[model samples]
Target: MATAGLITWPVTLTIGAGHLLAHNKHMRLLRSFGEALEEA
Candidate 1:
């Protein structure tokens, strides 16, 4: 529904922002982990 979407859109953006912040904070570690998984 349009109403539901309006309510969730900002919530989704907030969560996405938080995820980006965390990802940046651990980017190097995450990259190495991904590489290890690929090699497995």
Candidate 2:
């Protein structure tokens, strides 16, 4: 009972959203940094 309640839906959604947002922001920053390096 407790395992099923605590283990599934909410936790999966929370982790997925956090990872999605973080990876997107990281990619944007990496792209800008690459452009700057190329210009230099």
Candidate 3:
């Protein structure tokens, strides 16, 4: 069980990082799109 936890910890961190990055990218895109709409 300790070995399984050690292996999963890095996997969990990697997944969390990926989710955060994707969310940030999505928010950036939405902000840019809103700006474009305002300009138009």
Candidate 4:
């Protein structure tokens, strides 16, 4: 139904944003670790 789709669209976007934030955090950690390794 149209109503259902409207409800789900925001939920889907919220979930996508969460995933992107998590991925960015993970990548940042990995990058910092790589820098440490390079320094050592």
Task: List the global CA lDDT of all models.
Answer: 0.83, 0.88, 0.87, 0.87
Q: Judge candidate 4 at residue 14 and give its lDDT.
A: 87
TM-score of 3: 0.81
Model 3's alpha-carbon lDDT is 0.87
Clashing pairs in 1: none
Highest lDDT, which number?
A: 2
Model 1 lDDT per residue over 1-40, tens place: 3356755767787888999998887998889999999999
Candidate 4 residue runs with Cα over 4 Å from true position: 1-7
lDDT for each residue of candidate 3 in 2-38, tens digit (9 for 90 to 100): 3567557677888889999999999999999999999
Instruction: Tell me how candidate 2 scores on lDDT.
Output: 0.88
* lDDT tens digits, residue span 1-40, model 2: 3356866877788888999999999999999999999999
TM-score of each: 0.50, 0.72, 0.81, 0.82
Q: Per-residue alpha-carbon lDDT of model 4 for 1-40, expressed as tens digits?
A: 3356755767788888999999999999999999999999
> Worst 10-residue stretch by lDDT in candidate 4?
1-10
- Scored against the true structure, residue 7 in model 4 reaches a CA lDDT of 57
Quick one: best TM-score, which candidate?
4
Higher-lDDT candidate of 1 and 4: 4
Task: Score candidate 4 by TM-score against the native.
Answer: 0.82
Candidate 3 deviates by what RMSD?
3.8
